[model samples]
Target: MYQLKESRKLSNTEMKECLQISKSEFLEQINLECSGCISALKDFITLNRKDQFISIDQDIKLNDDLINSQRIFKTFAKLQSFGESIKSIISSIFKKTAPQNNKKRCQLHSLKQNPEINIQEHVHYICNEIVNQNEDCIIQDKEFDYHLQNYLKTKKFCPSCKENIQAALKHFKLQVPQPDCACSIICFIKYDHLKCEIHIPYDPILLNALLNKAQIQPFYQHASTKEDAQEELLICIGLLIKDRLSSLYRETQTQEIIKYIFYQQIGEIFKRRLENYSKMKGEHKSQLEELEQYLKKEVEQKDKQKKKRQLKKQKRKEQQLSFDGSVRANYLQESSRRSISPSNSEKNLLKSFGWQGSPSVSPQTRKELEFLQKEHLQEINNRRKQLREQTKQCWCEWCHHHKQK
Candidate 1:
């Protein structure tokens, strides 16, 4: 009773003394553990005193057989333990590394096949994790951990599964270091874009359309593994929506337009945004931050180009004004030169006719010629004045409406 209960061994004589019982009585009263112990003890120490210390060949052979039996049992036990350990090690390796027959799809696929699922909760959690990452800059801070704890209790969830996925989400949930993983971060950015940037809320039709489009995009269709491609897609989709809004339907409250845009732009936008993110930040970080940096770089580049264009435009305008001023200066100079009166010899009609004396025509004829000359000069001056007025109307810097009529 003491050996079995206390999980310890005592010599047969000690056991007998403690029980105050004989060997025969102990044997008769033995339980399961005590019987096994007694049997093992008897096998190891056979009390064959028939040849005690006599050094007989039979006695030595029996002792050798007993030692061999014990040695065989010990070796067999070690081998059994080694085999079990190898089996456990193999099972663990397959469990951790295998992809469940290669059927496991990413979060997008989960959302896609089961469109009826309320992703609003997932979206809410993503946003909360991002908004409060604590002082550690680690996304899975105490607050986030507490929220997850609260969430698991309040909300029931089965493991994320598909035709490809066989394991429970809890398995990966424990393994992932951050609650704000790429997929979740992307979802948070989408929520922020919808709520903060677009300033619209509760558009069931539009939200459904966007989510469905996300599943179809290549970025979403790709298998979720080591790579964080969902973040790329999220940035692209958000950008696409914003670009669509700014370009086409900014203020219109139309769900149809959003749906149309969703289908039209998702693929192209996904690719473009992925390329941009790779160019801007490489694979350094996997959060909304990668998208943010890409967008900031794009904006800075655009601003730089815009300033360059403005400067070029300003330079071209200045050059054109300078050329116009020089042309006008030469024209005015010619006009002033033309305004001088005719010389004395050019005013005499008699000189032109080769008559030296002033006796070829009557005063009335001269008066008529002078009147004709004055009228011709007046008409020429009037035409020049009209041309100047038309040029001013067409080319005047202050006249914005000159091209209208």
Candidate 2:
């Protein structure tokens, strides 16, 4: 019976046949005895009885057990189908959401035509100009040219300059009279050198204002041969101004040009003040050396005083030790005198009494006392022995007389 129950629980068909019962009867018995056993059998049959077909009963006590088994199989099949559906959905969403390319989008165009002015570019340009003019100077020509080209390519013009250049380039003939030369050499020259000769591309009034701020004259002046000294001085002044202007111009930004120009104008106004600061002589540097020596002397004096104090303390400690040693020696001498004086006197008194200067009895006196004690003990023992012998002889005599009677 146990074997049949186990077999039914295991869903073994041969064991099921051995039970000799219908499937409904077996399931009913399993349900009555153990619902878990019936469920386990249903699961095992669902897993292993793929080839065998069995009619499931709707009214069976284990109805949900069997239905759940079929439902699990159907759920797996639907999940497999859903995997494919999910892939399709993802593909469709990717297709619909993918970015598109549009080729006809509008872009902003710059209205001004001229290239930008860059401060670094201006520095590179000035550096090139200086190098070209002064070939003897130790300057790397190729490197400078490379830097200048890079500067030109990367340079951007200020908005004002761009507008002015675009207008000038657009209406070149109408604005300025044609020059004798292409003006390329003057145009490419350093700004300081071309200050009075070049015409800035702006309105005449604005150009005048720019020149005033730039501290440049309207036109280059020709020197008279008769005024050679004055011409030489003016040339010197112009050179100085040109150098200052070039340095400031290369470092100044377009937005800061006006401010830089104003700064330069102020610098010129205080030229004497600046020069005074530069030329003002300082006190002799040897004064610092003297002060250092004085400090050294003060430090040495302090060190010497410290050493003197240390020496004085050491000397006081030595003197105190010497005094203490003398006092201890005196105390020891006094104690020795007191202890030895009494002991020596006692020894002399003992020697006078015919006794050794020691606290022990003489050997002769000790032997005499011991001999007297031994003699007294011997007398006592002899008396006791004699009395005992007499008493015993009398008792023997008395006993012999009574026997005769």
lDDT of 1 by residue, 1-405 (tens): 221322123333332223232334433443323232345323322443322111112221112221232232332234234434433423322223332222333221222332222343233332343233331112222433344344333323233312112122223333424436544433222222122222222233343444554444342333234232333333234334333332222112122222222222222332233234334333344557778988999999999999999999999999999999998896676645444443464356435546464333344445665776677679899999999998897777556765566
The ten-residue window of minimal lDDT in model 2 covers 105-114
Q: Clashing residue pairs in candidate 2, if any?
A: 116-156, 116-157, 117-156, 117-157
lDDT of each: 0.37, 0.37
What is the TM-score (0 to 1) of candidate 1? 0.17
**lDDT over C-alpha atoms for residue 2 of model 1:** 22
- Candidate 2: tens digits of C-alpha lDDT, residues 1-405: 332222233322322222132444444433112233234344433331221112233321112333232242332243234335433432322223332233221011112221222223233444444334332211133433344334223334344433443343233223344345443322211211222222232122322232333343324233233233233222222333333334444333221322222222222322222223223311233567778999999999999999999999999999999999998897666555443322454444446546563343334433543565466568789999999899999999999999999
TM-score of each model, paired residue for residue: 0.17, 0.17
Q: Work out how many backbone clashes candidate 2 has.
A: 4
Off by over 4 Å in 1: 1-287, 340-405
